[model samples]
Target: MKYSYYALFTTNNQGRIEVTFPDLAPHVATFGNNLPDAQRMAADALVGYLLTAESLGIKLPQPSSFQDLTPDSQQRLIPIEVDTKSN
Candidate 1:
């Protein structure tokens, strides 16, 4: 199955892009140097989180709509896609 979740993308002080999933918790974050790299890392991070949650028998939360989130000036919302075909 493939899943997509909304993530917040922002730049760190050092200029690397950071991605954070708001609806899913035990809060995790990832970083990359550019938009595409950041997007790839975000998907990886979400996939890891879902696998870990599954292992612990925890339920994954539904993704929030883009309109529901309020991002700061530094943050933009992006979609992170995860494929669980092998899992």
Candidate 2:
């Protein structure tokens, strides 16, 4: 399934590209020194995250259009706040 994700990208202190999909809590990663490279790396990061979640039986939040969800649940998928780093 293709879920719509909100991505944020910016240069890091070390000059690498930082990327985040706010919809996925604690699911951020980074790579490369530019946007294109960072994008490929981010894609890899998502695949790895999902694979690991499936392997460990972690429950991924179901994808939903925030408008179709309750206000509380909607917050989880919105990019209200973001830190300038990756984990």
Best by TM-score: 1
lDDT of 1 by residue, 1-87 (tens): 688888999998988998888998546688899999999888888888888877789877788988888999989898787886765
Deviation in Å, model 1, residue 63 alpha carbon: 0.9
lDDT of 2: 0.57
State every prediction's TM-score relative to the real structure: 0.87, 0.59
**Best-performing candidate as measured by lDDT:** 1
Give the whole-model CA lDDT for all candidates, comma-separated.
0.84, 0.57
Candidate 1 residue runs with Cα over 4 Å from true position: none
Candidate 1: clashing pairs of residues? none
Could you give candidate 2's per-residue lDDT for residues 10-82 as a string of tens digits?
Answer: 5668877677665675775556577778777776677667667667888877554556544332122232222
Residue pairs whose backbone atoms clash in candidate 2:
none
